[model samples]
Target chain A: NAGVTQTPKFRILKIGQSMTLQCAQDMNHNYMYWYRQDPGMGLKLIYYSVGAGITDKGEVPNGYNVSRSTTEDFPLRLELAAPSQTSVYFCASSYSGQFSYNEQFFGPGTRLTVL
Target chain B: AQTVTQSQPEMSVQEAETVTLSCTYDTSENNYYLFWYKQPPSRQMILVIRQEAYKQQNATENRFSVNFQKAAKSFSLKISDSQLGDTAMYFCAFMTRHTPLVFGKGTRLSVIA
Candidate 1:
């Protein structure tokens, strides 16, 4: 399996511009997540989906949106980008079941720079 | 709320030596999971090891192991017979049922030959 894959490995956006970071998983995982990592900081969750059509906010969801219309794709949208949004974004997925300890598979991550 | 903390920002060790990276977390949930992820210069998040809070015995994966202290809320990773390939930024993470994983500021580890 390709596991999890993210598109646009590197991107630069002007202030007020918009773009979408695409994430896809071939493992058919029921849980998918979006996270952003700043320099010298831990990753903070932006949004997540338990399943298709069920999306929720996370710790730092401002200036971003997500849609999980299918099990394999969970795309993140950046609307009106700001410099504060400059960071490395990661996509991860995990198999959902009665247990909670399943390991999450992560993508290589996309580096975004907003000017 | 759940939070993971890695106290060490950077550490180095000679090849074939042993090194331990400390981690502590805050959570009220009794049952959860802890993980150590390694990110190299390539920027890929690799799962190194994992531990279940309810398991009394520690988890080991080849040269890597974890010391899980449920009562102390501490989960530290120990690397035995370290190699230069082990150089990476290590992250400690925590997760409860039905919640997003919480990550700590990564500890940069350099294995010198």
Candidate 2:
């Protein structure tokens, strides 16, 4: 089974360009998270969703928005991408009921470069 | 605020030998979880191992084991008989139920043949 999948493995955008990072999972997990990794830095949470139709702000959610309309899809939108928003984005999912929050499966990651 | 720290930015080990990567954290909560995640060149995050704060015993997964020192707030991962595939960036992370996870900068490991 494909655990977590993120589309647009690589992208380049302008200073004011807008784009969406798509994520999907077939595991039917209730918890999904969006994290970004900068050069030589750890992954920082951008947003999270406890379940379908419910999304919440994370530590670094300034330029991103997420919607979990279905159990399998979570899309992150960047209204006006900035240079600072350029980083490698990852989508992770977990089954928290039976497993701990640390047990998460991550996607391959989307590399975005903002010029 | 919870924070995770991995002092070593990079490490190297000889094949078939054992190596340890250190991780320390600070938190006020009594109950939480600690994890070690491996990221290869592909950049896909994989769970290496996990330990619960409430559990005193260390967590082990085959050749991978963790030394969990709750009082010192230190968790270190030890790999036995290291293989070439063990070379990757390892990240230490912490999280509590309903709370976001805190991750360290990460340690890049290289196993030489």
What TM-score against the true fold does each predicted structure earn? Answer: 0.98, 0.97
Q: List the residue pairs that clash in candidate 2.
A: none
Cα miss at A10, model 1 (Å)?
0.4
Reference-based lDDT, residue B11, model 2 = 99
Cα lDDT of model 1 by residue, B1-113, tens digit: 78788989999999999999999999998888899999999999999999988899999999999999888999999999999999999999988875678999999999999
List fnat per candidate, in order: 0.79, 0.67
Over the stretch A1-115, how does candidate 2's per-residue lDDT look in tens digits?
9889999999999999999999999998898999999999999999998899999998999988899999899999999989999899999898775236537888999999999
> Candidate 2 at A44: error in angstroms?
0.3
Output the worst ten-in-a-row residue range by lDDT, candidate 1 chain B: B93-102
lDDT by residue for model 2 (B51-108), tens: 9999999999999999999999999999999999999999999987657788999999
Clashing pairs in 1: none
A112 in model 2: Cα distance from truth in Å? 0.3
Candidate 1: which docking quality band? medium
Error of 2 at B22 (Å): 0.4
| Highest TM-score scorer | 1
Cα lDDT, model 1, residue B17: 100
DockQ of 2: 0.63
